[model samples]
Target chain A: MKRSERLVDMTKYLMERPHTLISLPFFAQRYDAAKSSISEDLAILKHTLATNQDGILETVAGAAGGVRYIPYIGKGHAEEYLGDLASRIEDPNRILPGGFVYLSDVLSNSQDLQWIGRLIATRYAYSDIDVVMTVETKGISLAQSVARYLNVPFVTARKRSKVTEGATVSVNYISSSLDRVAKMELPTRALKKNSNVLVVDDFMKGGGTLTGMEELAREFDSTVAGICVLCEADFDKEKLVEDYLSLVKISKIDTQKRIILAEPGNFLTETDFSQL
Target chain B: MKRSERLVDMTKYLMERPHTLISLPFFAQRYDAAKSSISEDLAILKHTLATNQDGILETVAGAAGGVRYIPYIGKGHAEEYLGDLASRIEDPNRILPGGFVYLSDVLSNSQDLQWIGRLIATRYAYSDIDVVMTVETKGISLAQSVARYLNVPFVTARKRSKVTEGATVSVNYISSSLDRVAKMELPTRALKKNSNVLVVDDFMKGGGTLTGMEELAREFDSTVAGICVLCEADFDKEKLVEDYLSLVKISKIDTQKRIILAEPGNFLTETDFSQL
Candidate 1:
């Protein structure tokens, strides 16, 4: 193939398999080009991605070395997206009966999921996250998206038991919203022992649900690499957990006046963006 | 930017937003280049994607002309992937209790999900699907993957209610696996009435779950564009629904003997590859 053709295919190929290494010889063989030419094509891809600031192409040296694309958004890009997302969350119409904000639309949106997933993945890019764990229903999609970029398995912790999953490990945590304790479980085979897990969820009020996931991670003898949520209800009376990241922080919600106050969360502060 | 750089950025931009139209003048202005130059760049992208049989760069000519990146996998690609997937599913270790096959690993693999989603999306690429629906738990990830490529919202029908979702519309169906009636619900605001929905699930036995999703979509005044599943147990005496596509079909399973049989599903025969 011609150099131009190789560049096009190489760009698509690298983008599709982020954080995956592709050796020079493999690209040369695939494109039927010289190793030197393949190297030059990769240089162009690396330079293009660097210029965009939305990704990074890390080059590993030596025989077993290759390029790995890292999905990353520049600090400026992260700030702008989070700002816009926070403003969107400020819509009072989203406030539910129990002080919970409806986020189904945002959670289901492909574009929003892509950005959220990329941001979360960027934060834990080098954390050795073997699996992405989240509770049932709401957090499933969030965990799936982050797992996609990280190229890891995502295990959902269910609130109820089903025969489909044979064996499980269960745990209980205070459901602050309901003012009662609730149980969550994960299939025994879903996660392996000693794996590094990153817990994620859609919302965090008192963070009871997240704590349950943390406990479940411990059940499998796994370590909690990090915890992140799309939204955090900062108006909550008290929090059950600390040292977690929230992408969008809801500072206040006025039920009677139908007012909501929100801003970018402390996620950025906790994330090391310098890796990009 | 140079024409080469423009093509690279344009491909990534269009791929990110599938099923959406962009006018030629928008790109022409974005690149500060002539409309003709922009047209040439799109042609390159179109030809590259076409040659790969992985995507379709649709050109909308005339007054409101632009391109669309249609996520598609050719028959050959689909066949190869399903064949490989079937062989992998044949592993005895995957055989769970009650003749169920464990598929969390495949469902959680991003590369596998991408191929499966693209293949399924290819069949329904032009089906006018407004939304994708699936039951809660395992089906959520598959729904999200397909929805992401189709650029549509996915709604999950839950087996149990949660306080997070304010109100819901529910339906009842016979759970053939359990030989009992079960109820499933979707949030009232999750889907719109009269929309076209594509129902998907990870596994199908009697397809009772899919029927429930179909009924739920009807309650929302939506039409079932189609139904598809990642795996369907062929040995499961009777099927409750028809006209559904299965990516892989498991013909038999013996837990005691540690034997299982699997093959490419009906998806290969049902999909048209000429679009490539």
Candidate 2:
């Protein structure tokens, strides 16, 4: 294959399987090109990705060395995206009865999911997240998005039991919204023992659901790599969990006046985009 | 940017947004290259993709035209993937109590989801699918995977109501497993009227849940573009709905004998891959 053709195929191949190593010998054999030529092609691919500030092609130097694609984003890009997302989320039409905001529209959007996934993956790029975990229904999309970019499988903990799953590990956390203890369960075989899990969700009220996930992680003898939510209700909220990150913080939601206030959360300050 | 660098970025861009049109001028401007140069880059991409038989880079000609990246697999590729998937589903260990098979592992597997999503997307690539719909719990992952490849938003119909989603549209369908009438609901604002919806699910027995989604789609003045399931059980079975596609068909599951039978469904023979 020609250099141009090889570059295109190489890019597509690397992007599909992120965090995986592709040795120079393998690329040379696949393209029927010389090892030196394959190395040069990778250099071009890596440089182009860096120039765009969208990804990183890390080169490992050793006998078992190769290139690993890391999903990274520029600081300017992150700030601009989060700002726009927060503005869209500030719309009062999303405010529901009892102060809950409707965010299914944003959660369901493919483009939004891509950006959100890439950003979260960028933050935890080096964290070695073995699995992505989230409580069922709303958090499924967010968890799936992050899992896609990270090239990892995501498991959802269900609010109620379904016979389809053979055996489950259940945990209870206070449903702060309703002020009741709620139970969530995960299939016993869904997650491996001692895996590093990253917990994600769509919304965080009193952080009760997150607590449930944290406890569930403990039951499996797994460690919580991080906790992140798409939106956090900052105002009318006594938080149950701490040391978590939110992409957008909802400071206020006035159902009577149909007003909502939102801004970028601690994610902006906590994430080190300077590495890009 | 040089041709080498452009090829890499172009591939990444196209992969990120599958089944979406990208104008030549957009690529030309992004790469700071001429129209002819961008055309040459895309030609290289198309050729490489065709050679791999894994994707299709379709060129749209006219005043409002550029290129589209469609995720498709050749017939041979689909057969191989489904064959492997069927064998995995045939494992006796997957059999749960009461004829139910455990599929949460397969549903959560990113690699498995990628192939399944591509296969389903290829079958309905040309269908004017305005939205993708599925019921909550297990089906969310399947819906998200298909929606990702289709580049469309997917909304889940919930089995239970939450305070988050305000007004809703609920429908009833017989729960085959439970042998009772069951209800599922979607937020009123989740789906638009007159949409062409594609219903998808992880597993289908009586297909009561699929019917509920169909009725919900009808309430919104929408047409069912198609219905597809990841796995369909033919053992111990009678089906409630007909005229649907199944990627994998489970012919038998003997709990006492510790045996199972599975194979590719009618979907393989029914789909036409000639467009690629």
Candidate 3:
């Protein structure tokens, strides 16, 4: 293959397997090119990605050295996307009963998922996340997207018992949004022991569901590496969890008046964007 | 940018925005290159993708011409993956109580979702599907994966209503797996009217859930583009729906005897491989 041809395929290959190491010799052999030529192709890829501010290609030097693609986004891109996302959430039609907002369209969009996945994956690019975990229903898509970019597995915690999952460990947490005690469960075989799990959700009212996930992680002997949500109801009652990241913050929602107020969450100020 | 750099970036850009048209002038302007140079670069990408049998770069020739990256997989690749997937499903350890199979690992694995998504997308690459639809819980990830590949939105039907979704339209269907009448709902604005939807699920026994989704699609005056499932139990009672595609067929499962049988389903014979 020509150098141009090899470069195209290499970029696609590396992007598909983010955080996966691919050695120079492997690329050289696959493209039938010299090692020095493969190195040049990678140099071009790394430069292009850095210029785009969307990804990073890290090269490790050693006998076991290889290049790993880290899915990331520039601070400017993050601000723009989150700003637009917040504006979209501010639409009056989104206000629902009980101060809830209808944001399913954003969550179900392919383009939105790609952007949100890259942003979240960038936040924990170096956190050594063993798996992305979320509860069933709305959060599953978020977990899947982040897990895809992070190149890991995702496990969904279920609220109700199902026959398909063999055995599960259940935990009870206060559902602040519903103002009741709710139970969540995870399959016994879903997660491994002592694994670092990233907990994500579509929405967080008082963060009661996120706490439940943290407790469930403890039952499996897994560590809660981080917690993030797409939207946080900041105007609600006191929060149940303090250390968490949110991409969008909904400050107010008047169901009777069809009003909603939102803005970008603390994820911007919290993320370290020096890599860009 | 140089030709080599442009090829790499162009490939990544097109792959990211599958099924979306990109005019030549846009690429020429973005890369600060002549139209001829941009065309040559896309040619190299199209040829390389065709050689790999993984994707197709479709070029449109007209005043509003552009390129579209169609996610496709070769017939050989499909056969190998589905065969391996079927064999993996044959493990007796996956048999849960009441003839249920524990395949959450496959459903949640990023690599598996990628392959499954590509395979299903290849089958409906030309089906003109406007949206991918599935019920809540297990099928959400599959629907998201396929939707990502197809570059379309996905709408998930819920078994129960949630506050965040507001009003919903629901339908009742017989849950053949459990032999009970169960209700499923979708938010009022979840799907647009008269859209073409492809219904997907993680598993199908009597396909009661799929039927419910089909009914929900009809309630919105939408068309059922197709129905696909990751796995279907062939030994189960008579199927409730026809004209569906399944990747794997589980013929039998004897939990006490520790035996299970699996094989590739009709998707291979049904798909046209001439595009490769």
Candidate 4:
């Protein structure tokens, strides 16, 4: 193939498989080009991605080395996106009964998920995460999106067991929203032992669900690489867990007055974009 | 930017926003290149995608001219993937109590979702779908995957209402798996009226869940563009719904004998790849 054609295919290929290595010889064989020419094509791809500040093409040296695409969003892009997202969350229409904010619209948006997924993946690009974990229903989309960018499988823990999942491991945690103890479980075979897991969710209130996930990870002898939520209710005085991140923080919500206040969360400060 | 760099960026940009039209001038301005140069770059992208039979760069001409990236998979690729997927489903270890097949592993796989999403997107690339809808729990990931490729938002219909969703519109259907009447609901504001919705799910026995989703779509005054499931239990004698597509068909599962049988469904024969 010609250089131009190769560049287009190469970009698509690398973007689809983020955090995956592609050796130079493999590219040369696929394109029927010389190794030096393949290197040149990769250089153009690397430079183009850098110029756009959307991704990074890391080159590993030596015989077993190759180029790996990292879905790294620039700090400016992150700030702008989060700012817009926070403002969107500020709309009073989002305030629901009992101080709950309706975020189904934003959570369902593909474009929003793409940006959020890339932002979270960028933060853990080098975290060597083995898998992504989230609870059922609302958290599934967030987990899937982050897993896509990280190029890893995601496991969803369910509140109830189904026959389709076979045997499972269950955990109980306080449901702050309902002020009751809630039970959740995961398929026994869904996650492997000693795996590094990244826990994600759509919303966080008392962080009880996150604590439950941490406990579940312990049952499997796994490590919690990180915990992140798309939104956090900052006004909730009590929390069951610490050492977590949130993309947007909801500081206040007046149910009677229909008022809401939101801003970008600690994710902006906690993530080191400079690592790219 | 040079044509080589432009090609890489253009490919990435178009792939990111599938089914959305981008005008020639938009790319020209983004890359600081001439209109003619941008056209040449799009042509190269179109050719490369076509040669690979993975995507379609559709050109719309006239005063409002632009290009759209359709995530279309060739028949060969579809056959290969579904064949392999069916073979994987044939493992006796996947069989659980009551003849239920364990598919959480496959469903949680990111690479598998990518292929499944692209395949489903290919089938509905030109179906003018306004939104993708599925029930809560397992189907959320499938819905999100197809929604991402279709460039549309996906709404999950919950089996039980939650305070976070606010007002909900519900429907009652007979759950064939449990042989009992069941109810499912979607938030009132989650779906728009008169939308063309594509219904998807992880598995189908009597397709009761899919029927409920169709009814829920009807409640919103939306039309059902199509219905698809990742797997269908063909051994089940009766079905509540028809006019649907399945990627894999499970013919039999003998728990005592430790045997299972599976094969690709009607999707391969039903989808018209010639449109690309």
Fnat per model, in the order given?
0.56, 0.92, 0.94, 0.96
**lDDT tens readout by residue for model 3, B147-225:** 9999999999988888789889999999888789999999989999999999999999999999999999999999999
Predictions in order: lDDT: 0.88, 0.90, 0.93, 0.93
- Name the TM-score of candidate 3: 0.99
Task: Rank candidates by lDDT, best first.
Answer: 3, 4, 2, 1
**Which DockQ-derived CAPRI band holds candidate 4?**
high
- TM-score, each model? 0.97, 0.98, 0.99, 0.99
In model 4, pairs of residues that clash are none
lDDT of 4 by residue, A80-167 (tens): 9999999999999888888888999988999999999999999999999999999987888899999999999999988888888888
Off by over 4 Å in 2: none
Local accuracy of candidate 2 as per-residue lDDT tens digits, A44-109:
988998898999999999999999988899988899999999999989889888888889998888
Q: Lowest summed lDDT over 10 consecutive residues: which window, candidate 4 chain A?
A: A267-276
lDDT of 1 by residue, A93-142 (tens): 88887677889999999999999999999999988789899888888889
Regions of candidate 3 where Cα sits further than 4 Å from its true position: none
Clashing residue pairs in all predictions, respectively, total: 0, 0, 0, 0
**What lDDT tens digits, residue by residue, belong to model 3 across residues A133-173?**
99988898899999999999999999998989988999999
What's the distance in Å from true for residue A122, model 3?
Answer: 0.2
Badly placed stretches (over 4 Å) of model 4 are none
- Where model 1 places Cα greater than 4 Å from the true spot, the runs are none
